[model samples]
Target: MTDRQITTTLTSPEDTCALAARLGPLLRAGDVILLTGGIGAGKTHFARCLIRSVLLEDEDIPSPTFTLVQVYDTRQGELWHSDLYRLSGPDDCVELGLTDAFETAICLVEWPDKLQDLTPETALWLGFDAGPQDDARNLTLTWHTPRWDTVLKGLVA
Candidate 1:
């Protein structure tokens, strides 16, 4: 893990989507992205953009709020989008196959705080907060693994 962090201001949903598009190609199996944000904070929107970028197509990405997890097959590999808001504890994630997916798939996790001990130490954490202006969001990306250094550089480029 490195003490590297990137912060950006997204003025609109398009900016968030653009960031996701840039990040999508750098992801791979076994990578975990923990998304932290309050309700209506654009986490799902960002996930949708990332999934579409990875698939190289415009696909309907429904929120995993109720289902807990949504799996998508892509040319790169399997991508798992998970919303842990409904989970009661970290153990509950095991039953949802999140534990297995964390090892085999590219995981985009919403409400990742619920995972507690199950959370991967190498996971990239993206914290979202409301910006000063309406419709703006402040995104703080914290990198916890050396593998993300090049990817983060590319994103800045």
Candidate 2:
């Protein structure tokens, strides 16, 4: 299937959170989201929003930077939030159970460049950038598989 991409400018953190909340319900097992952005680009915030939305609660979602990975149990299944920034190589990902989670859980991966070729081909890629406004952010969502086409379309709609 052809790849699909959508870009949007979020003026505030609430806008970003709302976007994540809308997308969260559309996600399912075996879905992988690769988040790419520089520090303070709001990747973690976006992830937390998504996770909390899926859980349908105001849970405290923590960044996985220091701990590497955090797993959350939801009614739908397991959701994995992983930060690969601290890993030295892709092999470390296997040791951390990322490979397995990528196949079975809804994975939100930050700094996925650390995964190199190990990154899944079917993953949805999100690239965030600082917007013109100080508190705004530009988000680009790239879908590599047709599996996410409808959901992506709905998100932009």
Candidate 3:
């Protein structure tokens, strides 16, 4: 597979949400998106928007910080939103069933650094960063598979 990446700026929460919404429809069951960044970096916000975008009904999308993982039934299929921050080791991913979900559901993992060796090779990695403006955010998207190149085309331009 080919490796590729892109960087985009979100001037506000709306911008970030819009970006997430745009990507929602493109996800397939096996897709895994690893979100990495520091606190308040917009990882959950992005995941929330994405979940809402494809869901069949209104749902309260909460941060999985304490709950660890949240499962949703989107119109497309099962979606797993996970927060690995509280995890003590990569093996915790197995206990969460994330290892299996990674291949069967659309998975969004926040604080994926905790994943370490368990990180999926084909997963898309999206990193959030503080932008120049306090309300703005810089997002970097990277993937080692060719499918993303087609999926992300024109999404940023």
The best candidate by TM-score is 3
Best by lDDT: 3
The backbone clash count of each candidate, in order, is 0, 0, 0
- What shift in Å separates residue 101 of candidate 3 from its native position after superposition? 0.3
Q: Candidate 2's residue-wise lDDT over 1-157, tens digit each?
A: 5778889899899999999989898999999999999999999999999999888445778899999999998756999999999899899998999999988999999999889888999999999999989989999989878888877875763
Per-residue lDDT for 1-157 in model 1, tens only? 4568988899899888999988898899999999999999889999999999888455789999999999998666999999999889998999899989999999999999889999998898998999878889999988777878877885853
Query: Candidate 1, 75: how far from true, in Å?
Result: 2.5
Show where candidate 1 strays beyond 4 Å.
none
Task: Note the Cα lDDT for every prediction shown.
Answer: 0.89, 0.90, 0.93
Better of 1 and 2 by TM-score: 2
Better of 2 and 3 by TM-score: 3
Candidate 2 lDDT score at position 100: 94
TM-score of every model versus the real structure: 0.94, 0.95, 0.97
Query: Hey, what RMSD does candidate 3 come out at?
Result: 0.9
Clash total of candidate 2: 0
Clashes of 1: 0
Pairs that clash in candidate 1: none
